[model samples]
Target: MDWFYGPMVQMHALLAWCSVGLFLVRGLGHQFGGAWVMDERLRTLVFSSHLLIVISGISLWGALHHDPLYEPWMTAKFIALGVYFAVGHWALGRGEFRVIGYLLALLALGYVAAVSVTRQVLLGL
Candidate 1:
């Protein structure tokens, strides 16, 4: 059971990193070259990564259910992720609002990374 759980945890970590990577690349592409880059493709990739990130995150949370620190950070992270998803989807329409949505997504990603590392919510701590 321990061996199985360990590998599952590792897989979750890998997926989380991949999600962050995809989000970073997609966000940077839009920021740096929205005019030249294929906005639709990058947008699609970002949306896909968001789904992957959420799934991997949930798996990781399930694996760490016994840990005392897991619940709080996981809840906070999900709320942040939800806001990010909403912003991204909303921005798909209005051209001017897209930049704001991208910025919010970046902030949400930053929050995810920080919570993942520290395993503590700043507001809570």
Candidate 2:
């Protein structure tokens, strides 16, 4: 399955990084009072990417045959993904607290990326 799995994994990784930037753009646009139309465009892009991201992620998960019940790293990766999404959503909100959310989202995104690369909960240390 290398032919299929390889591209699936690559697509998932690319989308994950794109997601980080999308949240940053949306958050900064909201915090800085950027044009509403532009913000909407970014929002739409983010929303549209979600389906593709899910597809790629699920494909990778199946390709790896990850059993969260037995694999701690896999479980942690899933949890980190949830945290990333929650923080991104919070960051997209319009309020004084959105700045904090935006910053937290970046940290969460980093955690997700690290886990994906290391395949470890604590960087295998």
lDDT of 2: 0.78
Best by TM-score: 2
Which lDDT tens digits does candidate 1 get at residues 55-106? 7656666665645355687677767778867775544334676778877877
Top lDDT prediction, candidate number: 2
What RMSD does model 1 have? 3.8
lDDT per residue for candidate 2 within 2-119, as digits (tens), equals 7998788888778877876776666677778776625567668887788789888887778788888998777887887788778777776665687888788788778777887887
Residue 34 in candidate 1, Cα distance off native in Å: 4.7
